[model samples]
Target: MAPASPAGSAPASPRLPAPSRGRRPGMARLEVDRAFPRSPRGVLKIARTLVALAALICFLASDAHEAYTALAGMETVITGLFLLLYLLRLDARMRCLFWPLADIFNSVVAALFLLVVGLFAIIIKTNKGTLAGGVLGLILLVLCLVDVVLLCKKISLDKARGRSAPAK
Candidate 1:
C-alpha cells in the first residue's frame, strides 16, 4: 500500500480506472455531440466562402455578361429581402456563422448590384432597345437561385444536427 500523505499536505494520487474499450488511458472523453465550428464566427466564415465562390463565378465566366444585366436589376430587391430575413434571424438568436456587420455589408453590396443592373437595363433599352443584357441577367439569376438553395440546405443540416445533439 502507498504511504499516506502528511497532514496539511497534498493527498496521495489515486490510481485511475482503466478506460473503457476502444478508448486510450489518460485521454479525456469529449462530448461527441458538440457541434463543429460552434460559434457565430464559424458560420460567418462559411458564408464568406460561399459569397466568394459566387463572386468568382460572376467575374470569371465568359458567358455571364448577358445574365449579369438581368441579375443586376433584381439584385436590389433580392438583397433587401435578404437583409430583412437576416435581421429577423438575428432577432431570433439563430446561430449565424458570419459577423452581423459583414452580413449587412454583403446585403448592401447585393442591393448596389441591383441598382447597377437597373441603370444598365435602362441605358440599353433607351439606346439599343435590344435583348443584349438578357444572358448575364439569366446567369446571375441562376447563380442567386443556386446560392439560396445551397444556403437553405446547409441551414437545414445544421439545425438537424443541433437538434440531434444531447444537451450539454
Candidate 2:
C-alpha cells in the first residue's frame, strides 16, 4: 500500500488544484460539459462543410486553376474532421493535441474564402451553376461566422475559469 500523505500535502494530479478559501465549503466544482463545443459549433460546421462540398461538386472539372482545387480539397478534409470530432466527442480531448487558436484560425480562413470565392464567382459570370454555388458559399460563410463566434465565447469562458478550451 502507498504511504499516507503528510498532514499538509498537494494531490498528484496537475489538472486540478486543492480547494481554496475562495471557494465555498463542500460545493462541487463547476465544469464545462465534454460535449459543449460539439453542440452548435460542430453541428453548424457539418452543415457548412456539406454546402461547400456541394458547391465544389457543381463546379468540379470546370476550374483548371490549382487554387480552387486546393481549396476544394481543404474543404473536404475540414468536413470530414468536423463530422469525426462530433461523432467521436473529441473536442474536450483535443486541447493536448492542438491549441484553440487553430480552431479560430480555421474558421476565419474558411469564412474569408467562402465570402471571397462566392462573391467572385457570382459577379464574374452570370450562370445557373455559378449562381447556385455562389449562393451556397454565402450560406456557408454565415454558418462559419456563427461557429467562430461560438468558439470565441468558449475560449474566453475557459480562460476565465482557468481551464483549457478542451479541459479533458
Candidate 3:
C-alpha cells in the first residue's frame, strides 16, 4: 500500500543522469560498408594506396630528393583519405560534396604530378631506391589515369540513365 500526497500535491519524479556525448569503450559501433572493399572501385583504391606507400618507403629508404619524398607522402595520404571516405560511406552521408567529380579531379592532378616528379626521379637517380620509387610513381600514375577513366565512364552512364527516366 502506498501513501498519497497531502493537499492534492503532485508526487516527485526521479531524475536520470544525462547521457555522455563521447563514445564509450566497447559501446561505439562503426557502420562500415563491408562490401565496399570487395568492389572493383574499392580494390583499385586499395591498390593505389599500397603502391603509394611502397613508393614513399622506397623514397625514404633511399634518401631520395625531397620532392620525390614529398610527392609520394602526399599521394599516400590523399589516397588513404579517399579510401576511408568510401569505406565509411561518408560520401553518402555528406551531401554537400560531389565525390565523383572530386575523385576525378584528384586522379587527373595526381597523374600530372606523378608524371613530372617520376621522370625527374628516374633521370636524376643517385641510388637504387630513387629508381624504384620512380618506377612505382609511374605505376601510380597509370593507376590514377585508370581511376579517372573509370569515374568518367561511370558518371557518363549515370547521367545517361538519369536522362532516360521520365521527368517528375
Candidate 4:
C-alpha cells in the first residue's frame, strides 16, 4: 500500500503560479490623483496664477490710452512673474508626457521674455522707446492666459476622474 501523506503537509498541492509583477493586480490604474490647488503649494500657485490672470484682464479691459500709460512701467515685472510661473509649471509637467512639447514652448517663451526685459532695461537707460517692451509684454500675457486655460482643463479632467494627481 502507498504511504499516506501527513494532514496539511501534502506539498501544498503543487503551488499556484505567483501573480505577475509591475501591474495593478485587479484594479484600474489610477491616473491623476488630486486636482490642482489640492496642496498648500498648489494653492499658492493657483493664487499667483489667478492674480496674473486678473492683471492681464485688467490690462486688456481698460481703455488703451489710460491702461497703456498706467501699465507701461509694469510690463517687465508682470512678464517676469509670468515667465517664472510658466517655467515652474512646465518643469512639473515634463515628466507626464513622453515628448513634452509644452516644456519646449515654455522655454522658448521664457527666453524671449528674458531678452525683451533685458533689452527694455537697456533702452530705457538710453532714452529709447518702450514699444518693443510693450509688445513682448502683450505676448507673454497671452501665453499666460493660454497656460491658465490648459491648467483649468487638466484640473477639471482630474476631478472628473476622481484621482489625486501624483505629486511632482
User: 25-103 in candidate 3: lDDT tens per residue?
Assistant: 5664567999989988889999999999999999999999899999999999999999999898887777678788999
lDDT of 4 at 145: 48
Indicate which candidate wins on TM-score: 3
Error of 4 at 149 (Å): 0.4
Best by lDDT: 3
Displacement of the residue 152 alpha carbon in candidate 4, Å: 0.1
- lDDT, residue 30, candidate 1: 44
User: How would you encode candidate 2's per-residue C-alpha lDDT over 41-119 as one tens digit per residue?
Assistant: 6567667778778777655645523454456568768866766665665655565555456767887998898788778
What's model 3's TM-score? Answer: 0.80
Off by over 4 Å in 1: 1-75, 84-130, 163-168
Kindly indicate the candidate among 1 and 2 with the higher lDDT: 2
List runs of model 3 lying over 4 Å from the truth. Answer: 1-30, 163-168
Q: Per-residue lDDT tens digits of candidate 4, residues 1-168?
A: 667788866643677879876776775443443543475435544543454344344334442333333343344354445445444454344455522245345435544553555345335533222343344445545554455555556656766897446555
Summed backbone clashes in each candidate are 17, 0, 0, 6
C-alpha lDDT (0 to 100) for residue 53 of candidate 1: 42
**Relative to the unseen true structure, what is the C-alpha lDDT of residue 30 in candidate 2, on a scale of 0 to 100?**
45
Residue pairs clashing, model 3: none
- Native-referenced Cα lDDT, model 4: 0.46
TM-score-superior candidate, 1 or 2? 2
Whole-model alpha-carbon lDDT for candidate 1: 0.46
- In model 4, which residue pairs have backbone atoms overlapping below 3 Å? 32-164, 33-163, 33-164, 33-165, 34-164, 34-165
Alpha-carbon lDDT, every model? 0.46, 0.69, 0.91, 0.46
